[model samples]
Target: MSDFYIRLYKDSDYKVARQLFNSGNAKHTKKAFKHAMRQPHIWPPLLALLILPALDIVSFTTSIFAVVGAIVFLWFAAWRMYWSYVRLCFLDDMLDIRRYYLEQDGRCFWVAESGGQVVGTIAASPSSYPGGENHVELKRLSVSPSHRGKGIAKALCRTMIDFARHRGCKAVVLTTSLVQKDARKMYDKMGFRLTHNFYRPKPFTKLLDFKILFYQYDIPKLQ
Candidate 1:
């Protein structure tokens, strides 16, 4: 951790930051595939497809096509799910961090550097969630896969929390997925409390029980 330092995001950090963000999001594709497979709705169709062949109701060749089709569909669905999020991020704040964060008061983006290379990123902006106008939202908190367990994330989070405090924010809020267990644990350890547990409203996401967790850390009032 001593080898790393955190600083305000700069124009030169764009390439490495985008790479880190894309890779971080891409790593979840496997998890999404597994999650989709575990759904009971998914297994019912697969089981029915297998049953047809076992009962000789369908030719073995047909069964092979059915099972392979199911697998391929699931893989493609997972790929779309992962890339959809990446595209959304690019269309949103990541598309121009300086415009969304740097140019606004009570907003900022930071990167963690080690030996002149970007290893992590995080950003904070005023919240838009209901009843949270005075709160800050933490976003894009990702650490390089090779750089985990070294306190970079915590350092980045601490920086955001302090930034919120200085801006006189009432609290800090953020959203994450259940698949991000390490991040969930880190938020808990940092005194952030769960505020909402909900799934995305998309049909497949709801059917698969994919959940999004919201958390908030209340800032103590200054004397």
Candidate 2:
């Protein structure tokens, strides 16, 4: 059998991991939103207008008070929307790296090294619920753009699954957003099913246009 190595993340891998995550997120987000600008009715802006009424501090009984309140609310809303969008973009860029380096989980953090360089990572930890020994949570899994489609992610995932099984974890669960189609496909190929669909709306980022779906995977223990 060919030899490949996977291990826990180290402090030295932080910078490279951040770069990989940002680059991949940028590519994925752009590809997902390629047709966004072409839509006639921008959803974020419309939603902002609808919520203006609720922001009114003055009595809505008077026309003048209502109009002033609406104006003030819109100004703040627009500013918030712009800021939220910027933060969302930044968060998307840094998510994988952040989870890898900053997570408080203690089970394990696995990194795939090729030629002494970090190509991908998978982090897993035990479930927080009481008497949950038969389950583990795959928190964050990402592969560098340059090394994708080479089975790096799959190898890392399999390694984690095997480790979990050996530790008596009967199944593994993970969550990914709907925006990440490639990731969703990977999970499906690995036998994950769509267990839930939830909405995570961010109005402040001018991003009320999309909803994210959550996924779960139940991996059977090896015989």
Candidate 3:
């Protein structure tokens, strides 16, 4: 821990950051996928299988085709839901940190390095909150599993908060899944209040009941 320090992200850090994100996010994907299976997307197709029969909408041959279509719909929904989770969690804006966070004004991206090895990362970007341009949303907080409990994550988080304070931001916000109980706790311990708790991304997330919790740390309050 003495050797580790948090610093601005570099092009060279991109690969390791993406790798850490993928591996760290794999287990959560299962949780998200399971919740997705319970979404309305999957339910509609199943309901169609029952409704089409009750309505007697077709002849025997047509009914067979209808059943097949319903099955395909179910499969497609499952695949789509799972893929959405993957894209949302893995194919993130961190993939292009320069374009997404670095080049933009009031945005930042950083990585934690120890012995010249990037072991953790975090990023911040201006929030869209009305009249809150000074506010930032923290993103991509991750620590290498092999390096857990070494204080790298806490250090990275502190870096983001310090960066926000220097930037004159009002506060920093972040969102995490319910599956990330430890992360939520860490944020709480850091004085970030759970501002909102809900299933995010609207209709899709609503059906899955995929609970996402939002946290916010007031820079002035912390200081």
lDDT: which candidate is best?
1
Across 127-211, the per-residue lDDT of candidate 3 in tens digits comes to 8755456788888788888788887888888888888898778898887887677898788898999877875554445545568
What lDDT is reached at residue 141 by model 1?
Answer: 90
Top TM-score prediction, candidate number: 1
lDDT of the candidates, in the order given: 0.88, 0.62, 0.75
Candidate 2, 50-151: lDDT as tens digits: 565568733435545555575455445444543454456447534454463346543677788887888887777776534456678775577877778888
Report the CA-based lDDT of candidate 3 relative to the real structure: 0.75
* Decoy 2 TM-score against native: 0.62
Q: What are the clashing pairs of model 2?
A: 81-204, 84-205, 85-205
Q: What TM-score number comes out for model 3?
A: 0.72
Model 2 error, position 8 (Å): 2.3
State how far residue 138 of model 3 sits from its true place (Å): 0.5
Candidates in descending lDDT order: 1, 3, 2
* Lowest lDDT 10-residue stretch of candidate 1: 201-210
Ranking by TM-score: 1, 3, 2
**What is the Cα-based lDDT of residue 185 in candidate 2?**
86
- Estimated TM-score for each candidate: 0.94, 0.62, 0.72
- Tens digits of per-residue lDDT, candidate 1, 1-111, equal 288999999999888888888988788777877887887788888878888977989988898799999888777766676688888989998998888889988899999
Comparing 1 and 3 on lDDT, the stronger one:
1
